[model samples]
Target: MAGKKEDEQQKQLEFEQDEVLTVLARSGDASAFNELVRRHRLKAFTWASRISKDPHLSEDIVQEALIRAFLNLNSLAHNHRFLGWFKSIVRNQALMKMRRGGLYRRELPATALQTASMHQASVQVDDINSIMDYLIARSSQAENDGTSKDPQVLLERREWYGIIRAFLRVLTPREKSIFESFFFQECSPQEIAQLFQISVGNVYKIISRSRQKVQEERLSFLIRAQIRQRREDGLLKQNVLDPVSLKESGGSLLTGTEQLYRFVKARHPQLSLSYVDGMLLGAFLLNIEKSSVDMSSTNMIDRNYLITNGMLNLGMRVRYVEAFDFEPPDPNLTTEGIALAQGSVDLGMPAMVWELIHSEFGLIYGYDDMKQQFYGLDTQSDEMVPYEQLGRLQTRSLFVLGFVGDHPISPSDSLWRWCQMISRHARGQDQTFSGFVNGLAAYDTWMDVIRQRAIEPLGHAYTINVLRQSRKHAMICLAELVSEWGEVKSESEINQTIFNLLNKAEEQYAIVHDRYVELALLFPVPSGGEPNEPANAARAIELIKHIKYAEQLGIEWIEQIAERLEEHASRAHVPAIVENPPRAYIM
Candidate 1:
């Protein structure tokens, strides 16, 4: 009788386990969902924790990942391979997060692990310790010897373990949240931003810069280690090289300094690549000081006055765009902003630098360089690098626009006119004029739209938002052109729409707030003139009614404008668009 009871108990336990797996395999089972999460929670947590180097974020990443997994379960048509599929999602999400943060680490492969064990015995004899030793020795020399074949290598990798672990103390809650999404939770930047209700660029900037901060800690560690070693070995006193002196005496590498053209072009060939030269010149021109800040007071009575009058010069475009509009803080032209944007170039900046060296290429490089100079000061020699010179040399190796896209152009009032003027010139020419301009235009648009769109930096945010919305519209329009099963025979309409949208995206905001903000900052008025809300909303309504108004206007409305004031009262309890004149007379 006792043996039979034991048998029944064993069967009952088996039944319960089977039920758990079955329910997990099926949808609609809340208990099973909870069980699945509970079971995999630690594994997910550990993965995110390792990546983010923050534990609270680890929890957040895991929690968010599980929620997303639950929401997106419908996409998982099969269950048998769920674990592998889910793991893939987690890995992708983590990588995406890291990509946004701009934190890159060399990918470690299983081969690295296998080799670690094979050389364990001999490696142990050599007294290998500290991850730095493993990383430094293996990192630069991974190709030839396959010296990674040692189990002890894993032990030595523990050095970075503490460094990552220490990241918990530094992050703010939001940053911690972002870090977890990147390092631990393994959700993509798009996933996380959508999860938290923010822009992808915002997500990218937060995550990328956060890792930079933590990596800075690692750099600090290296510096301190050097200092300590030097002290222990009887080097000079620390008193001679304090932090204040170090800062005052030297510029941060992260900051820019004028370098010899040969030094930059030769040693850091990747950076000095030809395409980078154009970008460098363009960036320098973009940041130069403007001649006149106040357009209201300045006489622009004629169209050609921009050129004929000192007010309407190409140099004016350079200074105006650089001063009030630039968000990257192109301080002294070669600011950190330029480096950050350029660092994003693919193939490489060297290649891009090479491309800018040409005249026939865009000649905008020559145009920009010749017109704008550092502080509007002229150089002793007009020492312009000719366009033809770039053709003979290998183009700088930047592959940014080659694969996914190209290097970004800084957009300001100048870029819009520049592209239009160039495009206009291309209208009836057999020359490669427009194509080159188009390429530059495309590059600049990418920079303005994609790069800045990510951060949606202060000055350009409104414009970026409008353009992004329009791009989304273009994408949706393209989707509409497709049938249920396939694509259109020709995507000409789609292409044209995208092209048109990009062109308009450049000027939409500048025109709307045209010469308004410029005046606001100029006179230091305690209370600014009437906001554009009443007038602009009225115009917006007119624009809407003139066409399929509601359908035409797609940008999300902001409540910050006080419900359009006078328009607010008119629409308060009613959704009607009745043209009430009293609403326009708010004063």
Candidate 2:
């Protein structure tokens, strides 16, 4: 008895599974086929109803589609694919029915505008006839103007018809009938009065009131559609920032800085890439997470604030909008961040954002609202990120920066601001997060890890590669500064002294760059180049020490340059730095 009960239970479970039913049906099991029909009948009907826009016609279509699906069931090889295959048959039958009836138009029935009015019980039979007459007249006009072929014009016409139909529902039945005759049936005022046993004056008055009511609803519909189209247009326009390569860049933040620099130069054509990098001190910024067991330490820092500060030094008005939470990011903040990012893109600036394509800094260059995706550039590739997934990626944080406009500063003043930023970073002032070491202290932390032979080889190699790229950029920046100020053609001793200091700084950065390049080669990225092996580790340590010494000397030279600029400002009775420099707006 127990064995019989188990068999019955097993049979019941198989009956409940679609794959099982599909396989049995394919094998000519009549009862199994009937069960499949019973389960999917209502869904098939609903799909057909939406397509055919007539319940009676949809019922016939679904019935025919089901018969065809059953006859062709044996041709379906995969049981799991049965549902999708069955639905396609239903869709095909619906479309074939529409085409046979001369009602097909761009995936919807051509008679869609009249379907609601004709089928709804609230609309009288005579009202349906009047609506048909009205539709005929409008269809003739649409064809004459070539609007019948335009989907947008057809869509708008359908919306207007729907608005008119809904307005009629709000009126008394008698009033609805009279209005339909006058407006849709094209009855004269005298004829309408005679047919309704009312005075011609009353008929005209009724027509006026009904027209006013429908007009209000029509206006509202038009306003709503206009706003929707504008928003969709804003999103769909492909506003990709000219692509920047991510080949050798290590840190996502520096990659973002590179893209933002392009945006800045677009507005101020006189600014060079190296100059902008120097102003941001992109090469000098560093943060090391001592407790982090992997390569994330290379990018670990107070990223958003540091970017804001860098842009401020360049005399650019900027805003930093960020939302951060633990795993399962807050939906409300995600929504707010997306809006702000879209707003920035709409303003003709590529938004510098975080974790767009991955858990890394990147740029949101374009968007597609219809597809609900954002076009972004990152280390992986140019990718389309679904809008809903922006803040829900690995980092569970949203950070966006919009560069508004330039504030215009003299070259000397900009250079001075750069010095102050470099000084702060070198002193580890920007290290805000706990368990992290930044600026000059980051070097010591990194060296200590190497000494202990506790290096995550790949991460260590990646860090070395990133630092290498940064110092190379630093060398170029220093050279640009010296060349820029050397062209000043000034006899002032202070001007000459600043130029000399910058030249010395450029040499020191060059040495730092060379040392880093050697280290990068000694510990290649991805494979990590055997950094843990004793001899290699010793060589890497020596290179790192030389890199630190050269960078320190470079920082000292910048300090002297800043001092000389201050002295010159004092002698010229000009302020060395703007006291109330523009503040970065955080949203």
Assess each prediction's global lDDT (C-alpha) against the native: 0.33, 0.67
Candidate 1 C-alpha lDDT tens digits along 21-46: 43454657655565555455545754
Cand. 1 TM to true fold: 0.22
Count clashing pairs, candidate 1: 43
- Least lDDT summed over 10 consecutive residues: which range in candidate 1? 578-587
- Per-candidate TM-scores read 0.22, 0.53
Give one digit per residue, the lDDT tens place, for model 2 in 1-587.
Answer: 99657545544744578898888888888767777776777567755654665656777888899899989998887898887799889987986687577333323333334443433432222233223434554566577878777776466446545645765765677888898787655588899999999999999889777765554443334333433665767543335545553233433335666666655664555776666666777778777765333577655555555556667666677676555543333333355556666666776666777788777677777776556577777666788887666666785666677666666667777777778778878987654455568887788877776766768888877887777777777888888878877887286787788889999999999999899888888888789888778899788778878878888998999999888888677425223433222211111
Candidate 2: where is the Cα deviation over 4 Å? 1-254, 268-273, 291-294, 326-332, 357-359, 366-389, 489-491, 570-587
Best by TM-score: 2
